[model samples]
Structures are given as structure tokens and as C-alpha cells.
Target: MIHGSVVHDPTGSWDTKAPLDRDAHTALATAVLHWDQHTAPAPAPADVEQTALLLSGYLDRLARELHAALETLPHGQLPVRDHVAAEIALSQVRRWLDGPSGAFQGEPLAQAQSAARLVDTLHHAVDRTLGAHPPTAT
Candidate 1:
């Protein structure tokens, strides 16, 4: 059995609980940048707008999940290897937000990009935590 005081994997499966919604995330990213590729862009398609909204909702969820994963570890200690990936993902999201992509660029694209980044980081953090080898029984 997986060793941990809190068996929080809701599914009770051996695999990590956090799964990246890559399809939605990819769609959001594409929607965000699609307008830029057009010379004279028309209104965003219905699907694009919907994707943005979905991403926003997912981002909130992702944030919560990340917070929970971080809490699972001992105080001030982390699975360094996995945690590093999570950190990188967080930094990537931050960069995307602070960059022009975050400004929304007069559209939902920037916001979508920001949401995508959060999701990306969330996945990284969770993967690292769940994959970590628990402290061996002494």
C-alpha cells in the first residue's frame, strides 16, 4: 500500500490523483493566440469563448489542488525532484502572466493563457508529490 498518513487520492487508486486536462488546456492556449495570427480578426468563435470560460473555472480548481498537494508533505520539506518541476511550472505561469500574454490583449486570449499556465503547474506539482517515494519504514 502507498505509505502516507493521509490517503487523499480520492479515487483510492495507486496513481496520482491529479490529472492534467491537456485537451482543454491546449484548446485554451490555441484560442488565446489564434487572434494574433489573423490579419483582421473577426469576433472570437463561440467555441473559443467557451474554452476560455472553461479554463478559468479549471484554473481555480487547479490552484486548490496544488495547495492541497503542498500541504500533504511535511512542514518545510518537499520532494525536491518533483517539487522542482512544480516550481518551474509555477515560474512559467508567472512569466506568461507578467508578459504581454497576460494583458488579455483586448481579448480573452491573455486570460486563457494565464489559466493554461496555472493548470500546467498544478499538474506538475501533483505529479511530483504523488510520484514521490514515501520515507521507507525505519
Candidate 2:
């Protein structure tokens, strides 16, 4: 009798579908919360610094993942708007990460908050863009 292959790999080559790392997601929430001006008992300097570092690392990783996805997709598969949005979001994160003590200068928390928002935006934009181009049937 004919039989299917031993296993199915429904994902990127060696990458599969890389979900946002749990630690990064948690850092995102923490960064956003601590950076909020309304949050009582403001975060300590170390907390803010740590969050910023995590955010920077996540931004770097997320941007690369998004780029790989875009590169691998078939041309014209993703909507123009969605593609542009993802690019813009990526730019937002990349710009911040690249800048050494950007405009937020004396405000790392503010920077971290911005990074969190940018990363979140990039994450959603990539999801939307990729979702536009669903995987082909096996």
C-alpha cells in the first residue's frame, strides 16, 4: 500500500514558522507598561535599561525574520499595501535600533516604549502581509 512521508514540515526551511519568542513578548508588555507615563511607581533605571536592551535585541531579530519572509514569498503574492506597511514598520524599528541613543536621548524608557510599539506594529504588519499570501496546498 502507498504511504505518505514520515513527517510533515509546514514551515520555512529550518525555520518553520518562527513565532515571536515568549521572552520577547513578555519584555514587550513590560516595556510598554513601564514606559507609560500614567503607571504608578515608575520603573527603576535598571528596569528601563534592561527593557530597552531586550527590545533592541528583539527588534533586530524580528526585522531579520520579516525580511526573510518577504524575500521567500512569491512575487506579487502579498498585497501592495500590506507589503508597504510591513516595510514601513520594519523601518520604524530598524531606525530606532540603529540610532545610538536616538532622539529620546535622556529617556531610555521612552525609547523602549517606542521600540515596543514599533516592534508590535512590525509584528502585526508582517502577520497581515504574510496572511495575505497563505501557504499553498500540499
> Which candidate should be chosen as best, given lDDT against the real structure?
2
Q: What tens-digit string does per-residue lDDT give for candidate 2 at 1-138?
A: 998564554552443355668565756655475555565655787877777777776677778778878888788988888888888887777777666766346676776677677766777876886676667799
Q: Which ten residues in a row have the lowest lDDT in candidate 1?
A: 7-16
User: lDDT by residue for model 1 over 19-112, one digit each (tens)?
Assistant: 7676767665555655553576535656555665676556545555555666676754674666777666655544544566553445565555
Residue 51 shift from truth in candidate 2, angstroms: 0.7
- Per-candidate TM equals 0.50, 0.72
| Predictions in order: lDDT | 0.59, 0.71
Residue pairs that clash (backbone atoms under 3 angstroms), model 2? 12-16
Compare the candidates by TM-score and give the number of the best one. Answer: 2
Off by over 4 Å in 1: 1-36, 39-46, 80-105, 133-138
